[model samples]
Target: MNQQAEEILKFYERQGKPAGQEEILGALQELQQVLGCIPKEVQEETAKRLGVKPSFLSAFIKKYPGFKEVSAVHEIHVCTGPSCGSKDALKILRALEQESAQKERKEGISVKIVKGRCTRRCAKGPNIKVNGELCHHMTPEQAADLIRRL
Candidate 1:
C-alpha cells in the first residue's frame, strides 16, 4: 500500500474542498509532499480533479515558493539580506554547502543550500533556516553541526 500517498490524501480531506484557486494550491502542495516535485501527469490529473486549467496550475507553480519543480530531502536557506550578509551569512552558507557535500556521500542525504533575500529577523543578522526552522546568529561551526547531525 502507498502509505505516503494515503497520508497525503487524508491531509487533502482535512483541508476541505477548495472551490477555486485555493483548492488548486492546496491540492498541488499535498501532491508535492507525496511526489516530491509534481510531474506532468500529476499536474494534469490535479487540474482535472480541481476543474482548473493547466495554465493556471503552471502559473501557480512558477510563482509560489512552496511549489517546487525540483525536490530535495533537506533544504537550508541562508539569509542574504543586508543585515545577515553583514554578519557573515555567506560564510555560514559556504560552510553548510561544504558539509552537505560530505554528508551527501556518507549518508545519502540530499541537501540544497539556497540564498534568500530575507528571513525577516534583521536583528538576528547572520540568520538561516533549516527546512523551515529559523536559526538566529549563525556561525560556520553551528551551521556545519546542524547539517552533519542530519
Candidate 2:
C-alpha cells in the first residue's frame, strides 16, 4: 500500500468498523482530503474494501464534484451570482486567469480558476476565493494581484 492509502485506511480503522459499501463516498472523500488527487491504486483498494469494482469508484469520481484527477497548489473561484455578476466579478476572473500563467508554469504553482455561484456572502458581491480564503468586494486589480502571488 502507498503512504496515502495507509493513512486513509487508518482513518477508517479508527472507527472500529470497516467502511461499508454505502460509505464508499465517504471513504473516497477522505482519500481526496488526504492525497489531494485520488490515485488509481487507492481507488482499486477502496473498491475492494467496499466490495465493489474499481470501475464503480471511477464513475463516482467522474460524476462527483469533490473528487479531482489532478491536484492544484492553489484554487481561485470567482463568484458569478446575481450580485457578484452585477458587480463585475467576470472581469476579475478574466484578469486572474490571464495573470496565472495557466498554460505553462515552470514555477510549479498550478492555479485553478472556476466560475462559481453565490458564495452565500451575496451581499459581499464581487468576491473571490484564493485557496479557500474569501476576499470580499474585490476588483480586477485586486484579484490579479492575488493570482500573481500564486
Best by TM-score: 1
lDDT of 2 by residue, 30-139 (tens): 77776667766666776666666778778988898878755556888899988899999889988888877642132324677889756889887788888888899999
Model 1 agreement with the true structure over 31-89: per-residue lDDT tens digits: 77766676555555555555567777778888997776544479888998888988998
Tell me the lDDT of model 1 at 63. 92
**Distance from true position, residue 118, model 1, in Å?**
0.3
Candidate models: Cα lDDT each: 0.74, 0.73
TM-score of each prediction: 0.52, 0.49
Give all candidate RMSDs, comma-separated. 11.5, 11.1
Worst 10 residues of 2 by lDDT: 101-110
- In order of listing, the candidates' clash counts read 1, 0
Candidate 1 C-alpha RMSD relative to the actual structure: 11.5
